[model samples]
Target: MNSFLTSGLIHAAFWVVVGLTFGGAVLAVFPRKIVYNVLGLIVCLSGVAGLFLYLGSFFLALMQLLIYVGAICVAIVFAIMLSPPLHLEVPKRRMGKVVLSAGASGVFFVAIAAVIWKTVWHPAAERGADWSIVTIGHLLLTRYDLVFELISLVLLVAIIGAILTTGFSRRLSS
Candidate 1:
């Protein structure tokens, strides 16, 4: 057997990470406590960062840590703090709704899997092999200029909106 994938250490690490990610999802979405859910989301996102590292995208993995773990998760934490207690029990889902949701997600997953498996992925006919950060930046500015600009604009708008909303709410309440 190949030692890398089948080794005891590797297997242990893989299973642990999988368990953490799955468990985190359960924690984040389930339970009445919003705090626990947020904690779970953080754990889940960290696991995703680990997965990104394993997938040979160290840059993406670091970015995942910096952005998702740092910014989005922090924002969620702040939101939760602004809200009520986490100990409240949310209403249980109806069986039919649960089944429908499961069915919908399952179908979507299967459809995506089928499309991925059936499709043939080919690089451009005469693609240049440039995977450097500089190359990516260049591509972003030239080929994906609009998308790049749009994302920055969106983030800026979101920040301004968040500030405006919070300021307005405080004034109105006062």
Candidate 2:
């Protein structure tokens, strides 16, 4: 009975996290306010971290929280703060553009669904028991070094761009 209850609780929690993730994504995209978008992104990232925790990857969960939610979101918020307040009226979206975007999205969704339907997913024959932080760190530094460095570079460039843009906007406003 206890095991069944625990399983039921875990299942419910998983769905809740999924719901949070989807809701946050919608909130992030649909809102006109940048602040609300950032808040939604934070919520979405937090939900992803929770999903990672449920997957038994504590290290991944921590990294998701620390890097994405902690660093990126804070940086975005800072960028918004440094920029001048946007008081310009938003232009109305054209119906043609909306239809085009919707059609493109539909095509992409169909393609992805077809791929998923055709793919045969097989579980690993032998699962590795070494999910330790040290193993992951070593793998990241050794095997995935280039990818890791590229990600770092991208983040650095983004931060620099944000600062430069803010500076230029301030100068222009002055």
lDDT of each residue in 57-154, candidate 2, tens digit only: 88789889978997899888988787677784334578998999999999999999999999987654456447578688678879999998888788
Assess candidate 2 and give its TM-score to the true structure.
Answer: 0.56
Error of 1 at 75 (Å): 2.1
Worst 10 residues of 1 by lDDT: 83-92
On lDDT, the leading prediction is 2
Report lDDT per candidate.
Answer: 0.77, 0.86
* Total clashes for model 2: 0
User: Model 2 scores what on Cα lDDT?
Assistant: 0.86
Global CA lDDT of candidate 1, please?
0.77
Q: TM-scores of the models, in the given order?
A: 0.53, 0.56
Give the lDDT of residue 20 in candidate 1.
86
